[model samples]
Target: METTYFTKKDSIVRQIWGKADTILFIFAGAAAEFALNKAVDWLYYTGRLPKDPLGRLFSTVNYAKVIVFAEEKTAFQAIDQMNKIHAKIEENRGFKIPDWAYRDVLFMLIDYSIRAFEALERKLTLHEKEEVFQVFLKVGKGMKIADLPTNFKDWEIQRRSQLQDNFEYSDFTKDLFLQYKKHLGIIRYRLLLEAQILMAPKRIKELLNFRNQSILIAIIPFYRLSRIFKIDYILKELILPKDYKSDIKALDHSAAH
Candidate 1:
C-alpha cells in the first residue's frame, strides 16, 4: 500500500522514529519526566511503572509508533484510542489531568525527537525541526490539549516553562530510578541516566542531581563513524537491552504503509 504524506515511506519523521536507537534515546528523555513530574506520575498510579518501568515506556513508544506510521484512518483510530485511554484514567482518578502536564508530555516528544535524531544522525535543518514540532503538535491537537503555541519557536519558550513548573525530585523520582536500575542493570542504568542528563532540560538535570554531560555526545562520533563503515548495527546491538533486542531489530527505516 502507498503511504500518505504524514507517514510517507520516506517522510523525515518515519525515518527518525524508525531507528531503534532513536526511540530509545527519546525515551531516555521521557524517562526523566516520568521520574520527576508529579502530576504526570499520577497517570501511572496502577503501579505498572513501579514494577516494570522499561516495559511501560516501550508500551508508550509502541502506541506512538502505530500512530505515526499507520495509514491515515488507522493512525486516527490509534490516536482516538489513546485519547480514550487517557480519558478513562482521568475518570478513574476523579480529577482532570492538568493541561500543563499534558503539554509537558507533548513537549518531551518534540524535544526528544530532535535530540535522538541529532545524536544518531546529522543535525536537522530548521525546517526539519519544525516538522518534528508539527507532527507532535498534530498529536496534541488530536488529544484536544489546550493553549499550545502556534509554532516551534513559541513552543520552545513554553516548553522551558513547563519543564520548570512540572518537574521535581520527589520520592517517585527516587523509586523510579531504582526500578530503572533493577531493569537495566547497574551499568546500563548509569548509561541511561547519562543519556537522560544529556538530553534533559537544564532545570531537570538540576532536579535529578545529574551533572550536565553527554556521554552520548562523546560516543556519537563513534556511532557516526560506525555508520560510515556500515557497522552501526554492531554498536546498536551492544547498547540496547537483550530482552528487547529482537523487537528493536525489527524497526525499519522505511516501514510499509
Candidate 2:
C-alpha cells in the first residue's frame, strides 16, 4: 500500500523544510521575533525556553519535521499532541493563550519559511509562496486557531498588521536575548543576530535595533560554493553548539526519509 504524507512529496513546503540550513535560518528569525512578541511570557512560564533555548529549538524542529515529512495519521497525532501540551499549559496558567497569539506563531512559521528559504536558496514564485502559506494554514486549522486569513493576499495584510501590533520590546525580550547569548557563546550569538538580520522583517529589525545590513548577504555566494564543495558543514560546526552537532546533521537526512 502506498503511504500518504501530511505534506505532499513534491510540495514546496517539503523543499523549504528539507534542509538543515534553511531550518536553522527559520528558527534564527523566529528567535528574534519570539523575543519581542508580547506573548513571550508564555514561553517563560515553563522556564525551558530561557534555560535551554537551543534544545527547545531542536524540539520544535523535530515537531515541524514530523509534520512536514511524516505520514498523515502520524502528523495529526503530533499536532494533537501539541494542542494538548498547550492546553495543559493554559490549565496551569489559569487563562487561555490568546487566539491572536496562536495566530502569531502560525504566521511566524509561514513567514520565516519563505524568508529563510529565499535568503539561503532562491526566490520563491508567487504560487510557491502561496503554497507555503497554505501548508501552515492547514497546521493552524488543525490546532484550532481562530481568525486565520483565508488566502495568501489576506495573510499578507494580516501579517503586516500583526507585525505592527503584536510585538514590543519588553523585559522578556531582554532576558531572552541574554539566554540566547549565554547558550550560544559570544561569537555564535553574534552570528545568530546576523542570521536574524538576513531573515527578520523590517519591523523586527527596528524592534531589535538591528542594522539594515548583514554580512551574511555578502557571504552567501561563498557559502553556496562551499555547499557545492561539501565544506559547509565545517562552518556549521564552527557556528553551532557542539552538543547539537548530531541533531543538526540529522535534520539534513530526516526530510529525505
Candidate 3:
C-alpha cells in the first residue's frame, strides 16, 4: 500500500513549513503571543517553559513537524500523545485547560503560518490560506478541541476576537520575557523582538508595546537574496544561539530530504 501523509505531498502547508526561515518566523510570532496569553500559567505550571524558553520552542517545533511530515497513522499517534500529555497536566492541576485556550493555540498555528510565509515569501492565495486553516483544523479535531470555526473566513473572525479577548501583559508575561532574554541573551533577544514586530498581529504588538516598525522589514530583501545564493543559513545561525545550531539546521526539511 502507498503511504498516506498527514499533509499531502504537494501541499502549500508543507511548502510554508518546510523551510527553516519561515518556521523561525512562525515561532517568533508564537513566542510573543504565548507570553501574552491568559493561559500562559499552564505553560509555567511545569517550570519547563520558564527554565528554557528556546528549548521549549524547539521541542514544540519538533512536535509540529512530526504532525506535518509524518504518515497519517504516525501523525494521529503523535496527536494522541499530545492529548494524553495535556490530560495528565489537567489531572495534576485539578481542572481542564480552557477550551478557548486550546482554540487560541490552534489559531496561532494557522495565523503565524500565513504571516510568516507572507513575510518571508509571498502572499498566499485565498485557497492556499484555506488549505493552511483546514490542516490545523483537522489537528484541532484530533485533539478533541471543541467549537473550532469550521472554515477559513469564520476562523479569521474568531482569530481576531481571540486576540482581543485572550491576551494581556500579566506578571506571567513579564517573567516569561525575562526568561526569554536570559536564555537568548541580549543581542539575540533583541532580534527576536524585531522578528515578532514583523510577524505578530496589531493587538499583540500593542499589548507588548513593540514599535510599529521592525528593522527586519528592511533586512528581509537582503535575506531573501542570500537564500538565492544558498548562504541564508549563516544568518539563521547568527540569529540563534550556538547551542541550537543543529536544531536550527534541522528545521530546513529541504536539507534533510
Candidate 4:
C-alpha cells in the first residue's frame, strides 16, 4: 500500500505575521498597551461597587461611551500602529495590513472591548453604542485622559522655542502648548502646520507637505496625538533638541522677546 503522502501546501497568513522589527514593535506596542490600561482603569474606577445602583450602572455606560468615541477619532493612531506591526514583521519576514483594512480593525477592537463588558451582565443595544461613543468623545478627549499635564508643558516650550528660531517659516497657527507658569495651564504657540490641517481638511496633501520637515523633534508626541501638542510630543521635541533647553540665550529668549 502506497502510504500517506501528506504535503501541507497551505501556507500561513501573510496578512497576520509580517516581520520582526522587535525594538520598534516593543515601543509601539507599549504605547498601544499604555492607552488601553488607562482606559480600562477608568472603567474600573467608574464601575460603582456599591452606592446608588442606577447611578453606578449609568456611570459604567458613560465610561463605555468614552472608549468608543476615542476609537472613532483616534482610529488613525491605531492605523499608524499597523505600520509598527508591519515594520517589525517585515523585518523578519514580510506581511502587511492595508491602509483600508486598518479602520475596520480599529473599530472591531473598540467595539469588542466594550461589547465584552456589556455582554457579561448588561445587555447593550446598538443605540447604547452610539450614545456612548458621542458622549464620551466630547468629554474625555479634552481631559487629556492618558497623559500627565507636565508632558503637555514641555512640548509647548519646545515647539515655541523651535518656532521662535524658525518663525519666519511659520505658515499658520500650528499652536504649541506649554504649561502656564505656577499653575496647571497649557499655553499654545502658533504654527503653520495647524493652519493647513484644520483649515482645509479636503486638501490633505497640502496638510502633510511639511510633516517630516515641520519639526523633527527627538521626543515624538505619543503616537496617538502626535499631531497635537501632546506631552509625549514634548519629551521628544524638547529633550532631544541640540542645546535647545540648556542654551541660556534660548532660555532668555523664551522668557524675553
Candidate ranking (lDDT, best to worst):
2, 3, 1, 4
TM-score of 4: 0.20
Winner on TM-score (1 vs 3): 3
- All candidates' lDDT scores? 0.80, 0.91, 0.90, 0.27
- Per-residue lDDT, model 3, residue 16, is 86
Candidate 4 or 2, higher TM-score:
2
lDDT tens per residue, model 2, 1-257: 99998888899999889899999998898888889999999988999999998788678767887798888899889999999999999999999999999899889999999999999889999999999998888889899999999899999999999999999999999998999999889999999999999898999999999999999999999999999999998898888799888888888886677
Q: What's the C-alpha lDDT at position 97 in model 4? A: 30
Q: Give the per-residue lDDT digits (tens) of candidate 3, residues 64-165.
A: 877998889999999999999999999999999999999998899899999999999999999999999999998999999999999999999999999999
**Stretches of model 3 off by over 4 angstroms after superposition:** 254-257
lDDT of 1 by residue, 119-165 (tens): 77778988888888888888888889999997889988998888777
> What's each prediction's TM-score?
0.92, 0.98, 0.97, 0.20
TM-score of 3: 0.97
- Residue 213's lDDT in candidate 3: 95
User: Candidate 3: deviation at residue 92, Å?
Assistant: 1.0
Candidate 1 regions off by >4 Å? 1-5, 253-257
Q: How accurate is candidate 3 locally (lDDT)?
A: 0.90
Clashing pairs in 1: none
Clashes of each: 0, 0, 0, 23
The alpha-carbon deviation from the true structure for residue 25 of candidate 3, after best TM-score superposition, in angstroms, is: 0.4
Models, CA RMSD each: 2.0, 0.9, 1.1, 23.4
Count backbone clashes in candidate 3.
0
